[model samples]
Target: MAGFHVLTGSGSTIAHPKVRRIGVSDILDAMRSGLADFWDRPSHYVFLCLIYPVIGMILLTWASTGNALQLIFPLVAGFALLGPLAAIGLYEISRRRERGEDASWRYAFEVVKSPAIPSILAVGAMLMAIFLVWIFTAQALYAWLYGPTAPDALIGFIYEVLTTRQGWTLLLVGNFVGLLFALVVLSTTSVAFPMLLDRDVGAYAAVATSARVMLTNPLPILLWGLMVAALLVIGTIPLLVGLAVIFPILGHATWHLYRKTVVAPPERKRRR
Candidate 1:
């Protein structure tokens, strides 16, 4: 039998016969599958997410001793480094499901056990670099506005300007910059790791393909990106406790999204 090919909505081919284009319903189904798997193996999921608060508290405690703004550095670094590792568990689960195999904690670890570790770590390093740049920019802006030492008289003046028309405008500009940064990295790397795991493709190809997928399905991808952002924001509310569920669900859903997007090359026909 000829292998089936998954294609884009425009009929451009995507994945191999083993992988198919999943619909919105498939996304929901995958989420359900992920939730079921989570409940069945709650300990594994909980353990991974627990790192968030432990790290958050440690940073917060240190920040309390100094300027609160200092905590942002460590917090961003922690999320950048540890977040992907936590999501690896769900990636494994999704991989097993894709192969019609049992989804178990063992399968989750199997996802992390890859010769592609160095490549994934390299991708992680690139992400960290981008994040650090943003952090430094924000820090520089904050320092410029407040300064290392300012008189009490300057406080009123700064407050007036900060709350005025120009302040709002600057705020908007700052937010737009942050949003663009988030979107660029988010869209580029959303399916990056999963793609690497699913295929023998290099990390560069995985990241590039993920960006192409976003460009091809801009609106849907934008909505998906916003959903992830909102969820991550909410997950941070309860001292980061919500991450246990949110991270896993997002990770599994991402795998499904990836399955929906990229196509594998067509297999050559065999002579009869």
Candidate 2:
């Protein structure tokens, strides 16, 4: 039988047991275990993943109507930025179970122990910076194209451009760009965080393996991606309050899904 141990919020030492090969069902069971109490004791898991920007938007909206529009660009950009961090919680839950320990809300913060925190943060920061550049560039281009023109001319031009052949071309191009981005994210982080947590592998390897997994299972992964996107959009209503419930469930479910898709390497026997 696999060894079992306890975990607490104050943090205590427990010996690491021998690693065992786990199946997808094992991961699913763990997810069910983690969320079992969520229904009856919702408060305990409410803060599983703290999305700062959501709160920032609420505050900005409350503060100024003028600044509210500004929040949209940042909110969209920020979600992309924090996607990895949000996935970290799933990694934590899976990692804890792999070690035969109880996973809890406190374990969500244990990702910092993986030595991957720096790389994760660095990658997230770079992505956010790039997105900011894109947002500004898009705004600048729109201003240059339509600014200093008569109001009627500007509106008419926009309508014409949107309905013209050129507009359809641009729309198709935009769709392709979005598809590419989704595929990149799906492949890179599909099983990345949990892999990193389960083993001593670097974040880069985790990303590489995740990408490989996506390449191997394109159809199912694509369906999964579309499902996640749809659910997230639905959860955004009620001012993102729904996320407090939806995010954890999805995070836990993803851990189970990752386990199903990626096989963990067996533990090497020690030389006697």
Q: Over 4 Å off in model 1, which ranges?
A: 1-40, 68-86, 100-102, 149-171, 265-272
Tens-digit per-residue lDDT, 196-265, candidate 1: 6666455566677777776666776776667777777787788777776777777777777777777655
Tell how far residue 26 is off in model 1, in angstroms: 6.2
On the 0 to 100 scale, the lDDT of residue 92 in model 2 is 74
The stretch of ten residues in a row with the least summed lDDT in candidate 1 is 1-10
Candidate 2 per-residue C-alpha lDDT over 1-272 given as tens digits, one digit per residue, 9 for 90 to 100: 01111111111332222223344445446457445534533564576544633664565464345423322433443464345556676557655655567766676677776544544554455455545554454344334544533223334544655798754554455445445555666666766665555554444555666766667666666666676667666666766767677666666666666666666556622111
How well does candidate 1 match the true structure in TM-score terms? 0.73
TM-score of every candidate: 0.73, 0.65
Scored by CA lDDT, what does every candidate get? Answer: 0.61, 0.54
Off by over 4 Å in 2: 1-41, 50-53, 56-74, 77-81, 97-100, 122-176, 268-272
Supply candidate 1's per-residue lDDT for 228.
71
Error of 1 at 169 (Å): 6.0
Q: What lDDT score is found at residue 88 in candidate 2?
A: 71
